[model samples]
Target: MTDKLNFYFETAKSAKIGIWEINLESSQVFWNAVTRDIHEVPHYFIPSLEKGFSFYLEGENRTRIKRLTEKTISNGIPFNDKFQIITAKGNVKHVENIGQIVYKNEKPYKLIGTLQDITKEQNLIIELQLSVEKFSSIFSSANDAIFIIDTSNGLITDCNPRSSELTGYDNNELIGLHNSKLFPVELRTELRLFLKYNLNRNEYTLNETCIKTKSKDIIPVEIASGKKFEVDNITYLVCYIRDISERKNVEAKLNLLSLAASETTDTIVIANEKGEAVWANQAYLDLTGLNMEEVIGHKPGYLSKGPETDLNASLLMSKAIKNKESINITILNYSKNGEKYWFEVNITTVFDSKNNFVNFVGVGRNVTQRIEKEFALKSLLDVTNSQNNKLFNFTHIVSHNIRSHSSNLSMVVDVIENTDDINEKLSYFDLFKEGTEKLSESIEYLNEIITIQQKTNIEKTKIHLKSEIEKTRMALSLSIKESNILITDTIPDNLIVTVIPAYLDSILLNLFTNAIKYKSPERNATLEIGYEIIDNYTVINFRDNGIGLDLKKNKHKLFGMYKTFHGNEDAKGIGLFITKNQLEAMNGKIEVESEVGYGSNFKIYLNEK
Candidate 1:
């Protein structure tokens, strides 16, 4: 009996199984060597029933083992169950336990159980479950229609839900269906050839084709086949089919738009968000006289360069592009050959479906003729208004001055006729002669004004502006010195102005004399001359430190023939009147900024082209 017991113990130890026994009456516990090793306890370690139960983990493990032992003790019912335990080294291990009760005198006497570690087997089962769940999730929720095809016969063995929805067929109808039946009758042969060619290849193959639905409607689709795989002994292919009807529609629309852009007469250009040209229509190319090679990677605004281009307009365009804004502007741009043309363009920013700025679209056309006509009409209107003002002035002078002269002459004749004295009559002759001379001077001034008005169409020559100002200053040197006035000329020496020679000289002389004549009595007088280009016109500014006029009270009469502001004894007022007319004849204009006690600034605008 002892030899058989020893043999069973050795076998259990070798098999890595453990045994435990509890004495009911004495409440003692015993562990075999294998059980001691499983709990990581020393061979000589003492054991008790409570200590044996403590080795089981807390919560479920502890409660379950206690219940099993109690049941075996009360009813002698045997148990085979799994549990977890913490070893002496603080390691967790899964174990299978088997328990049976020993009876004595019709009552339980002892409990015995067998345990085996099963951590490795439990881990493998969990891993397999997770992998199956992951594959099932992906296969069920894939976006594209997926099919598993038996490559040997090109028959559909399995398919995802999307496949049924794409083909308007049920799962039962799709399974075992021939792959060629999915395509239109006309395209089935080609699709079969393509599949056969790529059957054994180790790479995915892609093609665009049409699929016929069960309802007999043909839908465009992009078909892609993943590398062939095998399950068991049968080879299978994963065929992915995606509907491409929307993409094809978009392509067709883009092609039509491209045709319109290429053939239209208006200029159209597409540029990247950085303002560099990416594409241009034929009209844009023709307008700029540039080929695609020259335009690409360059800003379309490069065409807005030349002597005549407006810098402000160019700056506005650049600012608009930087801010991703839309703008409409008419600007003068020069072609490759230096030919200037007025271009009216509307530039708009392009955005993607995500509302991200991507590019700019500029559509423009040549507006040179319309702009030139507008300028001509404006010039004609200015001339008409000037002529009307002069006519009004002439009528007022005639009505007031002719009647005064006639009344004075009549008075002189009455005195001579009523005097009846030779000396008296002779004295009246001197009065008559003085009146006639004043009348003749008035008539001469009017004639000069009429002559200035008629010289509107006279030819203009380009003259050095600073040189002319210097000459006029030299001519008025004596008066300048007498009035103690300082003159400052800041105009560029190379600055040239197109004007009638006599008119420019006359204008400069009037401006200089007026400054000297109006010198302030309280302080040293000074005049500064400067020039700037604005709105396609050259503006000459004459700023003076002098007693300024109250323009609010005298603005209307300031340029009238007989008007005067200051109480100067020699204030004739004819200088400014004639100066304004002269400027008008040359299609130029003058504006004055003046305050009562401060100073005056006179700006003369001349057409630059």
Candidate 2:
């Protein structure tokens, strides 16, 4: 019997199968060489009945095997099962367990079984089962509705729970419903035909259509679908339905907001952190006097700021933005035409959820009109204050001059009446007439000053600056010839300034005569007239080589009515005060550069075209 068992074991071993026998009477276990190898034990190793069962994994496999072995030995029953086991070498394996009980004298005798490794086949089966479960879960629980239909008949054969929930229909009510019932007939036919023709070429195709719910409400859905051929000679298709009503609503609101930004009057801009303009609204283009093509891909300063822009405000903007801060400030800015404009600009920094700096948003309101009105009011106030001061000074000078003339006439009358000589009396009468004439001349000079001050509506016309200077020199030809003053013009012939013509003519003539009147006794007098464009003004410089005033002592008196600086008898001081008033009325400015006994340079700034 032993040799016979050896023969069987050798045959089974060669075939890579495992065989075993269990003695019911002695509770001993016998394993063939192949079985021992399957259990990963040496040839001489022995396994008892308990040990043999333990080789099977704990829990289900071992419990099942032991129960079956007990039944097979006690009742002479046969058993066949597949189970997993952990080998002696600590490796997991799948195996088939087949056993039969042999009988002797009407009772069970011993148990014989065969074991075979089926690890690869068993693993593949388990994986397939898991895949099916995963797919079933997704199909039933997915957010989007899913439908399975028979392509040939366009009948909905099955649908996931999500489909019924999404469409407001019971699961049973959706079965066997034709696809056309869910949509308008025309759309249904078009979509079915499209799916039939193209489903075979790709994994999925998409179609956008509206579907009617059970309540008869129509909502848009996006369907993505694919098809497969079934063994029953039917074409089946699977579809995914996504409801886009909420997304569509959001898009409409976004479009409305975009329209508002485009049409609104406030200038809007989107810029990178570096202040390069990337996007701008129509108002921004209009505010800057620039077109879209000229605005984008450049600094915002290219359109809104320039050399005359307020540097402090720009610094504050840069500092705030660099620190990811939002700021609002009123700053000076220039337009494309070099016209000064003002904006109430608000800058906000954009950041992500993680608090990382993204970009900057700027909204600018064109506040030029408001700021210009403010400056106009301020200028008006300044002029009123200045005129009031001049009026007070004029009142005092008039009072004093009139009193002096009255007293001198009284003295002359006394001298005339007390003298018996008619010739001396006539001389005093002549002196009295001369004093009255002087008072008349003083009144006329006061009237001229008042006339210049009253000229607040001076109209400006374009005139060549050099041409105006030459005309004024001709008007003072007598004085220029007597004083032998050389007048040279270095202004460009084409240089133009917008000024009140009378004011320009008067200003140049006064400056020329003043130079001649105050000419140095030791040196020959010369006047150089020139002009250049500075910012928005044409600066005409009248530099003369003549006696200069001590500005430190007579700075305020230089432009005062009837205030004289020099001891020259011809220095009535009315000329310069009138000239200053005329320049101011034309919205011009003047400044003096002078030193005692050196020379005077008067710069007249006029609006330039």
Candidate 3:
């Protein structure tokens, strides 16, 4: 028996377990070497039941383990328990005690069991339990509503505390409810569609949808869902939902602001620092005659540059972009069809939240009409200045000419008065009379110039260029035939010019008379009349194959009053000056391109009206 007991003890030690036997009547307990080792004690350590009980915490666990051991030994009942044990060295161990009651002559005597050291296993179990508890706490306290719905039935089976709070429902009220009850009527259809599409594929999705609270109030929610399977062969859809009412409100307000920006009437373009367009509003599309696809990602100059655009516009833009400064400028731009327009653009830099330069926003207005008005005003000022200078020169010429003629007349009258011979007196009187008549004619001519200067209400009418040329030709028929000059009209038959009738006639008459008067003695005076329409102006070119002036020396005085270059017997020098003044008064201009001994080409620019 001793050898058998040693073998059993060796087997238990080899198994790394402990075996214990308790005699309930004597209250004694026997522990094997392994059992003592499990308690962190010496092999010789011994313990009693009462002492072992003391090792257990003072709680129902201790009482239950003691009662189970006592009852098993006294009543022949089997008992199994996991409890704490203490050894002679006062070391405690976690042990799983499984025992059976032993009987002698049909009466319970002792309890026999195996004590397995389970401290490591118990510690792992405790750690797992703690983790579960912490997870449960977080799940209950989370802000988002969490639900576990049975996929097979589409019924809500479990929900966290937050779910109840968010849905305005108690746990009992929500656990057995259908998921449809939590969704608004409109969203229920969407939910059905989503399930049909995703359920078969086991796909997950996050969606913004509306939910119905217990109070029947609709709440916006963002829902994230995933599929989960349980050990019991049950499938569940785990859904996390969050209230997004505030987010939705902010989004709505942002959408409204975007809509307002897009619909604005001013051309609005946003460009990145690289000078690439990032965003453009509807007004920009309308103003530039380009679609969003065509303009976005392109530079602003893409829509505003053409052959006639000023190079300085791009220079200013480059400087402003490099310095990140706001700039305002007026630029001549082209539309999609290459039609020229004027834009007044204001560009400003936009910064990010970190105050870093991010983009530039340009607001442009179509100032084509306004710019044209400004040009018109400037042109009028130029005309006014020219007219003023001409008037001053005309006044000076009138003073000089009238004084010369008056002095001549005065001298002649004095001679006639002092002379005794009737014949000499008569000749002096005749000469005086001629001088006075010449002065009178000069005064009349000055009055006509004054009238032309003061007259601002000249009726504008469209006159056919060919017919007007023909009329001037007919009116100067006597001079044309006398000068032996050849006149050719190369003007288009349908070409018409907007001008005052009298001014057009006078202009044509002056040009023709000059061509005849300055005819080259060595060459036939061939005159050519033609016109071309450019933008909003009609350019009439009158080229004369005549004895052109020395432009290098006389270009400045070519249109000056009383400045005669040819010194002809009938060179009054007033014709070209008055023609220039009249052309300017009518918002037109005359420019001459000439080569000495070659020919003169007079270009008259008249408003197209």
Candidate 4:
């Protein structure tokens, strides 16, 4: 029996547990080695009930342990307590103690108990409790209304303080209430159906809906709900609700503004101070053939001009933006398909309420038909001017030719009447014949000009460019060879032009003849002929290294009737005028670029068909 008891005591000591007992009648106490070690006492130190009780910490813990031990000893009950104790070494330790009374003759005699040093376990439990308290405070004090609802019955099971405040209700008022009652009357039915569907499908839904406040007023809310669950437990709905009344009002105002802008008829374009487009009304977008997305944030100049558009319009626009004033002008513009048109544009600068420049607004009206009428009037004026000049030149030529021929005729008649010799008579006859021939030539030249004017109907055909150039060169071969000119043919072989055959031939012949006739005496004449396609029209260039005219002095009359720059004997001064007329008759045009002493380049534009 002693050996077994010793083994048990050894086991208890090895396990770091302390055992103690006390007698209620004698107030005696006993303790094991482990218990003595826990108190930091010497092995031979005797323990009494009073001393054992004193080992407990002061304050509530000491009182608690003492009362428990006394009750168990006097009333034959059992007591268990977890408390703090201070050892002899002045170290604090956590202990769990259990005491039971040992009854003698059905009455309490002594109490026995076991004590466990549980300092580490007690500290861990305390840290866990603190962490739980921190999380609880955050959950309860959050601003967003949070609720846990029972999925089966749609009842509110839990709610945060914010939820109660937002609903104008207390925790007790909301705890057992159905969640559907919080929704507006019209939305409650929809929400109930939605919940049922979501439960069946096991999916989450986030949406905006109206909620009824305690005062029966509907408030816009955005609710995000999802399932919350634990292992082997039925899932409940967790919802977070936010007020969105202000956002909804802003969106409604924006929608109204958009609709108003779209329906307005006036062209409205809003651009930043830098001339970048910010917004445009529907009328403006439709007129410009551009979408809002394409124009926004882009410079308005990008849509107003193209390759062939007048550059002056862009310059004027820049000036207007810089000056920050309303500018009105008629501008030539290009459409999306490269068709040129005109617009009467009014650009005004917009300012903020504080009187600072903010943006520019440009309103434009298409004036293409009006400008076309203006061009037609100008062309008519040009034709009238040409007719007046032609009449004047013809009068001069007719007087000079007729007067010269009549004088010769008079001399022939005088010779025939006065001299009876056969040789004199024959000489007079020959003089008359030569004079008549000269008269016929003058009449024929005049008739040729009239014929060109009358034949305005241009018969278009595909004329090979290289072949036409070679033919012109062959016709003017004598002039080219005599002048020792170097002619470079840069005309592409496959290139062709659509024009009347007669007009094309006349245009080329006149240019070739002029290039040779105007050859520089000091240098070998160089002529270059080439062609290119520009905007659906074929442009043929004839360049000559000759004594160029002073274009600045006589550019206006360079292609006018009876105008001559060089005083060469063979200069009729009618070739360029005739060439230009012929080109115009065939729906073509001619432009000249020249510099004195360098050279001249005559460019002809013809349709490609």
Candidate 5:
């Protein structure tokens, strides 16, 4: 019996099992070498029953151990359980406890128990349980369908909840189903062959194919071959299937839009948010006479703007883009071949579903022909209106001037016929001669006016404006000297005008003569000539300090035929009228600002672009 007890003690010690005993009457604890090592205590350490219980973890562990110990001591009952305890080194360890009461003379005398450290085993078990729970949670909530297939027969061993939702099949129906059944008939054989290939390889393989649902609907899907794994000595493969039906639908729509944009006649250009051109359709390339290489990475219409393009329209488009707004503008654009065309472009801001600014889409329509026709119509209307005004002026001349001449002649002839003296009759002949001369002069003026109106198609030439003004001033040198007038020419040396040469000369002479003729007697006369560039026009301003007219009272008739001001006998009023017509014939216009007794300024606008 002593040898057997020693053998058992050696076996328990080798197995790292501990033995402990508590004397009930003495309240003392005895710990074997293995039990002392389990608590990380020295072999010489002595312990009491209370001190032994103190090593248990607080709360539930200590309370349960106390309860089990009291019951065993009172009824001599055996106890077996697991508990946690804090070792002497402050390490928490899991332990198994088995205790029984040793009876002496039918009364409980001592409590004996075995203690074994199970920390590593308990941690491994807990890790496995957590891993299984995590896998279950992910499988249930995944977006893509996951299938576990048995590599031997290509049969689906298991599927996730998403698999059931994707295939319209319950978990029971999906289990044990052949993996090929998930694909349509047309792709089933292909899937089988692909799976067979995947079994031999550990890497993933992806294929785009169609799958069949329970209702026979075919759905586009992308199947990714996952890594092969083994369970219970059987090899299995995981397949991740993702539905691509929406993606395929979006691709189809994009292709359709691309085709339409490429084939349409209207120019279409798509620009990035930075206002740089990213893409342009075939029509845009053709319209601009540019290749894609020249267009990409440049702003839309940047290479197409010419001197004739409306700056206002260009600015408006830029402003709209900066503000991320939409705008429509018709602007002149030039092609690569230097040909000009009008383009009506509608640019819209594009945004994503999140309302973020994406880009700009510009649709440009060629409106050159329509714009040209409109300009021609406007020119024709201007000509018609001008001719009608001339007709009205002629009617006034015939009714007012010619009728007065004829009446004078008739009255003089009547008086001469009623006269008895020969000298009186001879005097009437003098009056008759004067009347005929005046009528002939009036007819000559009418002919000159008609000729000016008829010369609208005369070719225009570019002439230095200052040089022309100097020449006109020299021609009127004597008049300027006689009137004591001062002339200041502030027009730039490079200032030039496009007009009929003869018309410009005539206009300059008239302006100089008028300034000299209308000099203010109160002060020495002064004239200031300057030029300004406004938009597409060059405005030549002739400002004079002279005896100005009451423009408020006579502004309406200022340029009318035979309308005279200042009561000067030689005013004729025809000079200004003829000057206006000459300017109009050359596609120019004149405006005047004058105040009574102060001065007059005339601004002539010329097409100098």
Candidate 6:
């Protein structure tokens, strides 16, 4: 019996297993050399039952050993368990301990068990479970089906629930099967060959293939294979399979919509959220005479911005889109040939699922024809209204002036009819002749006013400002010398303006004639005519030092027909009225400034270009 025990203990020592014994009532303990080595004590060291129990860790491990020891000593109950122990040098070790009560005269006397070092196996188990749990979390949570495959044999080692659900197979039926079962027979060969090639590359390989379900329905799928990895001495290939049927459907619908957009007559533009164009349809390209290269990555108005582009309108559209609001506006854009056209564009802001701006879709239609029609109608209406008002004023003035002369002649004829002396009758004849002459003169003046108002067509040419004024001054040289008028022309020598030739001559003649007619009774009359440029516009300032009118009271009637201020015989009040109308016909305006007794200044603004 001792020899057999020695053989078993020698074998146990070679395996790094420890053995122990406890004697009841004797209160003694025995540990083999193998056990002493596990506890980090000397080979010849001996221990009592108390010292043997102390090798166990405190708390649970020690208490468990004590309970087993007491049961064996009193009741002969046996216990087998694996637990922890602290070495003599304070090292934590995982070990298995088993104990059985030995019978001596039918009463329990000894308890023994084997303690083996299981630290390496236990730690490997923990590490394996941790890796599986981490990978399982990703596998199950992912939307796409994920599979773990043995790269060498092309066998499915593990797969997520999504893979089973997608293939209509349960976990029991899917594991240990070949991955090629998911594809058709013809594609299985291709897939297997593809795996062979990609495994050597050690990177992902993506391919579009068909996957077969349990019902034999072939569904399109996007298959991607990851590089091989080894865990626990087992090599695995991670594969991703994504069903692409929904994505293909979405793309098909988008292609149809794109075709529709191109076929429509209205101009269409699709752009990213930043207002940079990504796509422009056929109409937009044709309207601007631009190709894709000229339009893409550029703003909508960038191609059309010129001297006439409405910056305010473009700015408003930008602000509206930034705030995620749609805007509709009329924009004027120029084509490649420099011809201008108008389009009424409606832009809508698009948002994604998270309510973030994604794109701006704009649709525009050519409205140049409608705009031209409306402009023509507005011009006709304005011309008709002006003509009607002019006729009303002409009729009233003509009737009043002509009726006065006719009434005076009628009264003179009445005196002649009742007179008895030839001398009185003869006196009435001179009066009759004078009244007819006055009526004839008024008729001629009315004809002249009508002629001035009848002018509609204005052909303007560039004329030197200083030269025109000098010509008029020379024509009125006699009147200027008689009135002692000081004519000063401060206009620049190079100043030129576009004006109707006849109107420019007439305006200058009226200005000078008025200066001579309205000379201040208090001082020698002075007149200044000069030109200045402002905002690229030629401004002609006609300043006169003369008897200025009470503008506060007479301003309303200053340019009225036949209105006079100085009551001079030559002040027909027609020159200023003609001057004002002529300025308007030429797209110019006249502004006057003066005090009651100070001089008057007339400022005329005209286009410089």
Clashes of each: 0, 0, 0, 0, 0, 0
Q: Candidate 6, residues 331-376: lDDT per residue as tens digits?
A: 7888877889987999998888998888899999989999899999
Candidate 1 lDDT, 1-609, residue by residue in tens: 999989988999899899888888888888898888888899999988778889899999999999988888888899999888899999888888898988899777888878788878877877899999987887788888999999989899999899999999998999999999999989998998778767867579999999999999999999998888889999998899999999999999999999999999999989988899999999998988989998989999585599988999999999999999999999999999889999999999989999999899999999999999999999789878868877887888878877787788888888998987898899899999988877777778778888998877899899999899989988888898888899998899899998888988888888888888887888899999999999968999999988997999988878888787887877766778888888877878889999977789999888766
Per TM-score, the best of the predicted structures is 6
lDDT of each: 0.88, 0.84, 0.83, 0.82, 0.90, 0.84
Residue 468 lDDT (model 1): 91
Q: Tens digit of lDDT per residue, candidate 2, span 1-609?
A: 999977987888888889888877887788877788888988889789878888899999999999998787667779989999899999999999899987789677778889998899999999999999999999889988888888778788989898887788888988898877887665887777767766667477888888888998888888888656575887787888889889888989989978998999998888887777888899988778888778778767665678778889988888886777899999888877877878898999999999888888899898988998999999889989988987898798789887888788888888888999988888877899988987888889878878877877766788887788778877889888999998898887787778888888888888888888888887989998887778988888889888887888888678876778777887877788888888877777788999988999999888653
Candidate 5: tens digits of C-alpha lDDT, residues 475-573:
888888888899998888887788898988888888888888898999989999988888888888999999997888999999887888888888877
TM-score of each: 0.65, 0.69, 0.53, 0.44, 0.70, 0.72
Model 3 misplaced regions, further than 4 Å: 1-249, 271-279, 295-326, 334-340, 403-428, 451-553, 565-569, 579-609
Task: Return the clash pairs for model 4, or none.
Answer: none
**lDDT over C-alpha atoms for residue 309 of model 4:** 73
Which pairs, if any, clash in model 5?
none
The model with the greater lDDT, 1 or 4, is 1
Model 3: what TM-score? 0.53
Candidate 1 Cα deviation (angstroms), residue 568: 12
Models ranked on TM-score? 6, 5, 2, 1, 3, 4
Candidate 1 regions exceeding 4 Å error are 1-121, 261-391, 406-441, 461-580, 583-609
The TM-score that candidate 2 achieves is 0.69
Better of 1 and 2 by lDDT: 1
lDDT of 3 by residue, 273-382 (tens): 87788888888888778888888788876766899999988899889987888899988988887888898999999888999998898998899999999999997898
For candidate 5, what is the lDDT? 0.90
Off by over 4 Å in 4: 1-10, 13-120, 146-159, 170-211, 220-496, 500-509, 512-566, 577-609
lDDT of 4 by residue, 246-295 (tens): 89999999899778777876566778888888988887776677787878
